[model samples]
Target: MVSEEADSWGLGEGGSRSWPTSKPERVDDQVTVLNEHRRLSLQEIDNARFSWIHAKICFVAGAGFFADAYDIFAISIIVSMLGYVYGNEDGNLSPWQSTGLKVATPIGNLIGQLVFGSLADIFGRKRVYGAELVLMVTATFGQALAGHGRAVNIVDVLVLWRFVMGIGCGGDYPQSAILMSEFAPIRTRGRLMTAVFSCQGWGQLVAGLVGLITVSAYKGAIRDASYPAIYPVDCIWRIIVGFGCIPGLIAFYFRYTIPETPRFTMDIQRNIAQATRDINNILSARRHTVAKGLSSDTLVMAPRASLADFIKHFSEWNNLKVLVGTAYSWFALDIPFYSLTLNSSAILTYSNFGKIDGNSPNDVYESLFRICSGNLVLTVAGFLPGFWVSFCLIDSWGRKTIQFMGFIVLTVLFMIMGFAYVPLNSTGPGQHAFIFLYCLANFFQNFGPNTTTFIVPGEAFPTRYRSTAYGISAACGKIGAVVAQFALGHTLLNSNKDMQIVLEVLSFVMFTGILSTQLIPETNQKALEYLSNESQEAYITGAIERGVPLYA
Candidate 1:
């Protein structure tokens, strides 16, 4: 019998020591070894202080996300620039072309999330991490160089590349979240992971700055040209997008070198000895066996990951609910998020919050500058602050409470903006108030479900399924994003009435997210194993009575 206190993961106590006899017996030895193993693995992770390795991991993981955000959101501005250079008489892309550009990446993300997520679990995080970044970098640069061959229009070429980029972006979600969550101490896990996700704000901010800079750099040429300012405008979009790959390229080497998480090694690979040494390296000065008095390494026949095991584990409502909760919550949140976020330029103009006049060369400069300025204001005043505030309070206020509060507040804000659209935008003062509410909505989106959706799935599952489940959850969110991009293309860009309808619909969507939030457990300051709701005592069954050890 395993001891009740064998591991702090809620296993029951009381056991008798039985080493490998001529006939091997029960798991007192297995409990001791497994417990010590966890002390070195899970406990060390839960209790370890923040270190430089953690900082390095944060940058390596966050850099890819930064690139992801820059790529995705920059499209709104990119579309505007593309229209200026490539549009018909009015200097705007047709609705079909615009929708194609917006929708391709999320579709790609859906595929990447499912595929890369499982690949990471089946193969390994370290093996799968950098590949996505490479794909993203290649696709991003490819878009810049893409041309309008008669066989394939430049818009189609860009869309295809964007889809490829989306896959890479999708892969980063699970990889970064799983890696950051698994490696962090339970105490600081929420904050650290938020720190990585918060990079999205910085990415968005940088995209805006890049847009503003590129357009301004071509001001002289544009001022003297025709309405579309074809050559200068063409240069502007390419420069902004091509620059996205720089952040990813800078971090590629470090991502390639990042250590595989200990949980994956111990739980998935079933390698106790090597897992122990990994912890030892992380804690070189404080190295000592927590197993008290055990000598010689013994092979532990831990639970293995198999298809049957996966079905059996998630088949249970307890585990399935967490998955359901995470997926649906993310799905509901993204409906409004992706709709308004990616089409900010359109929404801003419709709300009269952003100023844009015509297709004239002078108008082009002003339009680009104002759109970037609007995005920057939203990022700095709303998105950035919301992320850091969540970082500070996520552990203390608890994930569930913050999620509930965020959804509720956003619901109210969206209704106010949606239902009162005419009155809110009727005057300069009214429009200013509308923009303030817009900023508030962005703030709560980050401080609330956005951060938690990314954080919870990574923490709530067992090691074997963590990345895969997170990917499923993230994919569900992208589905909503795909829907939103379609909405952004077809409806939200049209008129105030359409914007009003979408915002009203999104308020209800935010409310639905609150209900879904009920499905997930509060994962504050709990060991990942404890949150997994699995029995741990017999996790490592008995010493190697037969086959050779995986790591001796």
Candidate 2:
């Protein structure tokens, strides 16, 4: 049997010889540990008879994604309503003003992501998670009560409030993804993470539904020229924005009760006693058998790592490469993803599917309905498949390969939309065909880069720095969001007939994405924990062998 000191040093010690010590031996030990960990993780999953706890955590975190999607999209709905309130009596607003309101929130989103994301890493996920919820609620409610005049000049106030809310929303992306990933079992990691991530689709869908409801409420007022009745238009929009708060409140209340991750506790908190109990409980609950030699008191744990130590751990070249690759992929995904959503109303306005104030009765409602219909279809198609793909193939196919496929397809789709739009065919099958291609692009985004970009930041980092690393990566992504939001409105889709111009801009951006993706290595099958002492040594040494810079 292994002695206390031998076990203290782990499998490499005790000089058992057969237990693994050299590099090859260390690889063998990793296989053994991986096999054991995989089994234990699976057993724990089966035992979590309170699987609903897992589901609840997922839902709570996911609600934030939904809110982010909804809040961002609301900018478009409100802009559409604004056209009716303060445009030509015939009901059309200038494109520049329309674009400004639509894009301002994304700018806010970028700032929020960077500021709050870093906080999640420095503090704990639970604390920041709760605070962000309160911020989101306050800002959204603020938007609801902005002003009522025909030319209500609260644009600055609305923009600032949205920006504040965005910081909270931006905070949600990393916090939720990291939180869900930690709670998930390895085998089901993809499923749980993707499921939570897919909440964005639900949020978008809710936005579409809300748009439909809002439009329906105004249909009567809009149709009757004489009555000119007010339809809680501002309140309706407020309620939609305010709706995001309910889920956040629920998440905040429950998040306090949920324990920090056992892996996090093991890696960062160094509370081995509690970590061991949680780990064993997770395993025994699933397998219906006690751990053979494990006891809470007997379990040895690593010391809590300091921030300096954490940075020191990743001072190697390859580590930095992986970090850069992951961050770039995230940045690449956001440019088009956010640009499309933030500018979707402008796209619809130019598409001319219907008019806001044409001669026809209920024309605005019809136009709003069509946009919502398209969004609903796209969300269901892309997000639902994402959950399955991430669940079944993430480990098997690997992260880099899956993301590569996504980027490549996205590139091709963008090119298709670009070519279809170049001539700017105003009327006929060409325009309709262009619209179809645009919808297809949205579909591919959901199935491909959208899911993978978010997934990688969570999977790539160790638990101790998971939130911090994710925040950094997510902040980079929001930088892209800010650029897309502001630029697309000013340059890409600035004109009513520039649909093709917008497509070309995104196509150019997506090509760069395909190239940036080449930097990432495959990581699907690798276990998240430390492999072995020799392997850890090798990780440090291998980088030096290749002349990779070490930070510390």
Q: Best candidate per TM-score, number? A: 1
lDDT scores of the candidates, listed in order: 0.83, 0.62
Per-model TM-score on C-alpha atoms: 0.93, 0.80
Single out the weakest 10-residue window by summed lDDT for candidate 2: 537-546
For 1-552, candidate 1 gives per-residue lDDT tens digits of: 221232345322223323221221334644555655554456666667789878989999999999999999998788888887777777688988888899899999999999999998998899999999999999999999999866888998999999999999999999999999988877688889999999998899999999888877888988889656788888889999999989999989999889888888778876665666687787334664434222234445666778999999999999999999999999998888888888888877876645476788888887877887788888888898999899999888888999999999999999999999989889989988988999999999999999999999999998999899999999999999988878644687666688888889999999999899899998887778878888775667644423643222
lDDT of 1 at 361: 83
How would you encode candidate 2's per-residue C-alpha lDDT over 358-464 as one tens digit per residue? 52445555655665665555456554555556557665666667777777877887777767664445666766676666666766676667777787778676666
Question: Which regions in candidate 1 have their CA more than 4 angstroms from the true location?
Answer: 1-27, 289-299, 353-355, 545-552
lDDT of 2: 0.62
Give the number of the best model, judged by lDDT. Answer: 1
